[model samples]
Target chain A: MTNKTEKKGFSRRQFLKASGAASAVAGGAGLGLFGYEAGKDPRTYRGWENWEGVNQVFNRKKYAVDQPTCQKVGPTRRVDARTEVIFYRRGSFMRQWREETGLEGMEPHIQEYYRKNPEDLELDIYSQEVIFPKLMEDRKKYQDQFRLSDAWSNAMGAVSPPRITEPPEVSDFPRRSRRGGSTEPVKFKDPKKTSKLIKKIAHELGSTLVGIAKLNPDWVYKYTSIGRGFQSDEPIEVPKHWQNAIVVGTPMSWDPMYANPNYGTSNDAYSRSRIIAFRVASFIKQLGYAARPHTPGTDYDLMVPPILVDAGIGEQSRPSIVVTPELGLNFRPAIITTNLPLHPDKPISFGVQDFCDHCKICAENCPSDAISYGDRVEVRGYLRWQVNTAKCLNFWNSTLGSMGCRLCVAVCPYTRKSNWIHKAALKVTADDPTGISEKALTMMQKRFYPGPEPQKYYIPSLGGENASYREPPWWLRTEDFIE
Target chain B: MQFFISGWFWFLEGILTCLMVVGLKFYMEDKGIPMPFWKWILFGLWILLAGFTIAFVGTSLGEGEPTAAKLGGILFGLTSTISGIALWRILLTGRNKT
Candidate 1:
């Protein structure tokens, strides 16, 4: 047999050297391009700074508060002012829907699904045996210190809202520093400086993304539900003077999120956000302002997406969630409402709407088909793509394998790690404004990372799990230390 | 049975299987074997089915065993299948291609 290498006049060692040199050149060129796209400053591509000035120009132009989009009062009402979907009212739907479905509730429904498919049940069992116990242990260790509420205990009105009894206490030092031992508010004359300082403080205290927004009454919930049963429906009266909101978002780990819809990574992200929010709220309170932290497991006074949008943190996407430029949908936001004087950020327009319009990946991948494939509709006064909440919740409740279905968040092309390629694509899409760059980027994403097959039962593999989670580093595993 | 009960042993078995498959692929390529892509895919499917069967049988028979043992059994089965599949694909791709 003729030797292919000799026939081609290239030895293996010579070929390897040539290829190595070529790869080195290619790698250098790629890094150079990435450096240029990232900007001259190294900090622009590092940590929370990636979001700095990301969609500033576009946001200032299109979705600014003074813009026509914000000016118009449509049929679906602006999210900030929409009063129809109160917390208790929304909670009531779970019971009503459970009756409608004729299933006992989510647990029974999940049990039925597993019973029908023993193989899937086996997979679930394997995960429970291998993965969930450790996750639960970690959660138990951190639950008291990190989480302030237990809204996730029951998705229905059975545990609608957990009550907050004590008011946020201001620090003794700040209170004593004031004249006559009375707490006098430390006022900032410059809103811009205050906003910058607040953002810096938030970032330092573990916030992945932070922004400020002028408080909108429409965002506040009409009533808060505290605990289950009759006493749950308590009317909440938020003081109008709480004029500014400090919005902070913490990004979840990509590895576990990619691994499964609901996992330790998702829960950990929420816990971390709660801790960050609590600290931020306490910090604001020390400044002599009443600051209330609103986290995932807490009763929310304000709708998060609109507040995030108005804060210039992200744009509203098709899944009816805020998609940040830096983290995409892989983030959980916590809000701190305060009377602190701060300048609100302009709402960004980073072509998320355009990208979501073209990429129906989320809608297609939705387990229960809860996401809408159609154009943006006026729902509760906001002209945006609205998901079928009932259907979405039903899926969340019924999924025995996972806690919640974050398939949309997991599948989003934008929800990628902070790599240069993704960053470059983001820059291109943002700069174009027109859908041209977005279309190209979407196409590239589809080609490279094609969406997972619909309804394929994800069994956590024993050792060779393709989407398995990385063992969390020592710092994250707080369970190691006994309290 | 003793090997199947040990998690680390199963894990080691998976690694060894993976290494062996890799070595086989390299050896086959050096010997100029013209393995088709579809054949590799078919072989992978067979390996996957075999792995599934091993897991199913092990779990069913060792009902009283620790959950970790069952998990280890399933993991070893899966690892073997994945290793085989990966090797088959690597071999089919050849040295110049992928």
Candidate 2:
């Protein structure tokens, strides 16, 4: 054995030389991966020229001029007032049960699971035992700190209901005398041009995406209970004269959205949308027309998702939320019902349904198994994948000191940053009308970015020190607008 | 500090580890020693797995104060020490036999 080993012995000096050569090769490979070009300023890499010239070669915009409009596969039906998730939660029976038994109407299995695995109940206990109690004890202060946007939205709730009377006439406004006035409604001469202008204004007022649809009566709720709690059983009727609807979306920042089950981060998108919707409604009103904005924390007669679909904004994904080409499910939609004559957009189909069919990441990662992995089914007249709302709400109420769950938004493949690599993939997926590329794309996504692991939220920066709910940034709070 | 939490740090670490393993293999070959290629590969994989296991267990058992970076650093240190001991054994075995 010694003789055989001696024959294969290597000198230290020779080994050192070989190691140096290998190091050089490795260094070269590392540099190659960066794809750095000589004499090019990296800071100027994102200039318009790069986007229009070089980037366009790889990322052809996926929109087609003559793509067929998407069709609703089933007949439309009004959502039953009793069946609505929020209404059911607010019902006296459920509220009384929640107060009597601290279970929040959770299933037996979920409570049992928590009881069986006490160690895994850390978050649940911390939320229920500590955070929620403190928040409730000082409700006003906590509301200001944690739910500033919600409070503001609630304050603006009076505007959400249709006004009983028109505003008092301004002296300077061009108008006929009231006694023998020309009562003819003002005609918008150019519908297409006016629609474009409205969209531009909405975008300027902080809407991420803006689309118009001829108001579908089926999308309107037959009756809606206003405000929190079941104080009055009176149902508000939606007026039929509001013939057009403007759907607007605003995106939540990724940092907060990624920190799911957390209150401030998860609800920031909703708050931002509320602010935008209010401003857009005001703008529309100034154009000599009636505009009623439906915002978060306010009574709403319209179902937002179906309206968004009809407006050509996005398609509903597996989690029963609209996923747009630009932002996936990381945005909130608000509606402005108006009688303004505007050209409505056709419903768009960019292969989102096919991609969602193949990619069940959201369903798999859902803590409550609330998201469905099955095919679309007709529900209340719309053919779509529906989530188990009871399971989802129960999970939300039981964890993380917050009444929300954004796990679906956090894990969506399309919720990636708009970098070059993602843009390329998106372009390809959008162009593949037949959805033949979905399986390969899904595989690539999994390989590149693995699913979230257990106890993944234990990082100190994400949870302990900087874990306090994030306040809205100055830009979000300030009223200043750039021209 | 942000780099540690960001995904890029892991990518860089993976590239560095691969390079280190390649260099070690080349060094053994140049020394005229018939490389125990399978043994080296197994050792590398074992170290990686052990490091990951330590991080997972440490974070799981810890009160919510340990960041991913802190746990990752602990894993790196522990794995590096083990790898050094392993390499020493290999060198000693090779030299003494010769």
Candidate 3:
């Protein structure tokens, strides 16, 4: 019976009524939206304030850890299956680099490889097209990116040892306990407390994260890469004193990380991480425990990711490295093998498996199309998203200025810096109870953070110029600030 | 009260609401399009959604999440708000039998 014009007028009473209803609906939805995850995390997760009080805002659930992709659960290979020592870098063209100090030709190593495997064609194409041209071009003109990349490496290399060996800092000369001056190793009545102390000490020594895992011979490498062009030929065995392996991690600098697929970020994180490894190893030695640090550049006798997963460092992602809930893809791990009594942490899951299934931002943005857009494939004894490391490295060599391409790392939604809004969005997406949020979140990620043409990152001759995820920092590239 | 306070709801919401109001006014008053009552509600809701997008952009920017994401979001939110206003103008022009 209400007149049409009166209805169109929107009376004051009707406006107030609609406004009250909207306020009530919005309030109720907010209470429900936020109230769901409250009081769930009984433990007060410390520091890195963004993750603090996160539960009150976002629904984050830390589920039980899953088995790492590298771990061949329920052993299939015997101790002496194929004695010629599996070189982890066998496929990587890095093995072909001319010298211990990189940025050189791989002509001789590539010829030797063809002699060994007549069927190997991937590296053949890579060398002919990418590496040879890069080295030839390197002589003519040195780009600003390569110069910046070399500067970062040289800075780190200033402190780097020639080969992988125990740092002098990890000596047992002061083995006598400060409390008792006892020559005997300090004894722990409870392994749990020792584990806690180890973590506390590692954190105090500037470790971003610390975890312990039992030594798995399966994760140990047959031969250790001591330095470029030098790897131990004799079988590197996990020593008897090395019963527990401590995995410590630190996040990469976000400033440089924003401009990844460039030289500024990766080694910067590793330099800090490798030092943390030595410090933790030294602390164990001071406790009269034998320990060995396997650092980032050339010191590892173990597969870092599998051991990191074994120690509950993080869950494996589509890109194959472990991603932590706290740091996401912006993390690097350093391991220390020791005889110290420490509790092992179980593998953890933070919903990466499901999230990566739907989100292909990394694969889509990879410059050389190296990251797989296909479904997870079973390779070796485990399943993972297989990437052409040769193509990836070739892109690294061909990138206008740098020798490393972290395009995949830079574009990943998980590789975000720790902030409150990201915290909430990531938490909901990780919990992903409805399954709808994952798809919705991925859609939003693509829309808001849309990638440039992947080809834009290639060399000029290769049909693209160096368009980056974000511009490199001003200090590194002199042109940015120069008059 | 505790949720809104520690959770930074008011700070985020209060800023975003002001942005939404400004965004809606920026578009709606351009040609002085006479809004129908229901169209006003739809226009308001669309502007509110765009505010959410802006809030998301600012939060992400502070976190080193991608520069492209921030720029795209600002572009998309402001453009979409104008499109929302234009949508209503088209409908009002459609009622041209007078």
Candidate 4:
């Protein structure tokens, strides 16, 4: 045979004996997978079927917040002044029709009701105006029961740095410093005295949610890099000047983030957080103060549970992460620290704990089985749900190419899009705090919605050339547009 | 002897590897060879290293020295040339009819 023919027709036996052995040696030396055995073959692609570990790597113990905190953080409502009214009534006649019909309709009575009771709709007689205030009152009343502090109230009134003159006993908590205190000290401060200006600036920089809280060492991991203040042989002392933290959250786009599970989706989220961190930190620095942006690669400090809870952003849920009411687990967070005085937002509770007690969509959908199935257990002086970090991380390592698995977050019922119908159920859930909310949520998941579908994997760089799952650019082809 | 090899060439190897992987995935798909998970694992590692190499070289090539993050923003651009060339070649060749 010719040389080309000889090479093309090479036997598997000969290939195995010569090149395969060499490739195995090189693969072992390079990536450290065990040298390929003669008969042991490996499967190429299992896609989401073999994917596990969505919860493990991210939900590890040191990072896990208590479950009640998760619940408290999850159901937080956006306190926008612009509220929508679905049903309106004019006077006793409209009220009687509402009682009689029990539904919204453009009946003559309803139309007359709208004409007469436009002011009543403004008054929001049918719905309570002070739901947030009521929830805050309830949260304060049950603070110790929930294993929380009154950090929100304390962080208010802080416009300038906490000087020797302004409230000397800044509520005795020896945590990290405000400005990388000697590179790694606790920098948490009274949530009350944080800067409203900083909060506004953070919002301008794309932060939809913001909060402030005092630092706590226990909330931080037991150990971290010396640069990060988990624990170091170096002497740990709280900074004298720096106190108070500004927690900022940038909500992920609900549509793309929920649909795409991999880093492609999350990388964009992380990138946004990094951007917000830079902007907020820089703004503080411009005001002739010290501001540190706590982000993944940039910050020198560690983020504990306070950033989520103290901000009234969301509650911690079954997956041991803060769940926002509007976007669920579809957001990334960062923190800024300085001496700027500002008002801190109070912790919010919208019945997420009671809601999660009956809802386990995330737990059911976790491919790695890393999320817990048991009841809330106490860990690190707080009762909370816990996930197996090792299992989650292993799954991440296994599925390197496909977007890192986010099956748990994707399947979360709370992560659904905001619509009027859902708002009604949520309002009732907030009012009751009973398992009715959970049942409604479950019914919504089971009866109203289709089951979880696997996320698709396609190479973005390859675009439409490889698989046809590319996100089409704005301009459609003439053929596609015509159809 | 090791110093004789250009660092740019290491990066070029990475760029070529990425392009070849793309080609291989398409080529193998047309030929019906199921790609193993290791191919993807290798893909991630190579992409990361290539990114690092670009940042390191780009920093030294500049006046103030660019950060890895800044370099990361443009690493895809640099690789786009080779990948784009490969894509253009494929476009010119028309669809593979395997």
Highest DockQ: which candidate?
Answer: 3
Q: Tens-digit lDDT track for model 1 on A1-483?
A: 368757564355455444544543443333333333332223332333434333222233454544312223465332221113423333432333343453244344344543564544343334334444544554444344212112222222242223445433321123444455445678687989988898888877878778888887667665444431112234445565568888986765554455444332345566667777878877876777777777775446557888888888888888988888777888789888887888888777767777888888788878657799998876565677877654564444333323455778877877755544456567788678667877766765555454445544232221211121223233323345435
User: Over the stretch A1-483, how does candidate 4's per-residue lDDT look in tens digits?
Assistant: 698776764553354434434542333232211111100111111111122211111112222233325333232221111111121122222334343443254444344444664653433332232322443444344323212111211222122221111111232222345754332222336534435555656666666556666544433322222244223323334444346667765544343344333322454445566667767765655544555556632233444344676556667788877776655666567766655555655566766676777687777656456788888865544567877643453333222212345556656666544432334455566567456656855765543333332222212221111111112222222234433
Leading candidate by TM-score: 3
lDDT of candidate 2 at residue A362, scale 0 to 100:
86
Per-model DockQ against the true two-chain complex = 0.02, 0.05, 0.08, 0.03
Off by over 4 Å in 2: A1-71, A91-186, A227-237, A401-403, A454-483, B1-98
Query: By the lDDT metric, which is better: model 2 or model 3?
Result: 3
Top candidate, metric lDDT: 3
**Angstrom error at residue A130, model 4:** 55
Structural similarity to truth (TM-score) of each candidate: 0.57, 0.57, 0.70, 0.45
Of the true contacts between chains A and B, what fraction does model 3 have? 0.06
Q: Considering only chain A, what is the TM-score of each predicted structure?
A: 0.66, 0.66, 0.75, 0.53
Q: List the lowest-lDDT window of 10 residues for candidate 3 chain B.
A: B22-31
- Which stretches of model 4 miss by more than 4 angstroms? A1-194, A226-242, A262-264, A297-300, A400-403, A452-483, B1-98
Worst 10 residues of 1 chain A by lDDT: A461-470
Taking the tens digit of each residue's C-alpha lDDT, what string does model 3 give over A343-414? Answer: 787776667778888888888888777778787766544556776765676677666554466777777887
Candidates sorted on DockQ, descending: 3, 2, 4, 1
Q: Measured by TM-score, how close is model 4 to the native structure?
A: 0.45
Worst 10 residues of 2 chain A by lDDT: A51-60
Model 3: pairs clashing at backbone N, Cα or C within 3 Å: A65-A347, A65-A348, A146-A401, A261-A406
Global lDDT of model 4:
0.45
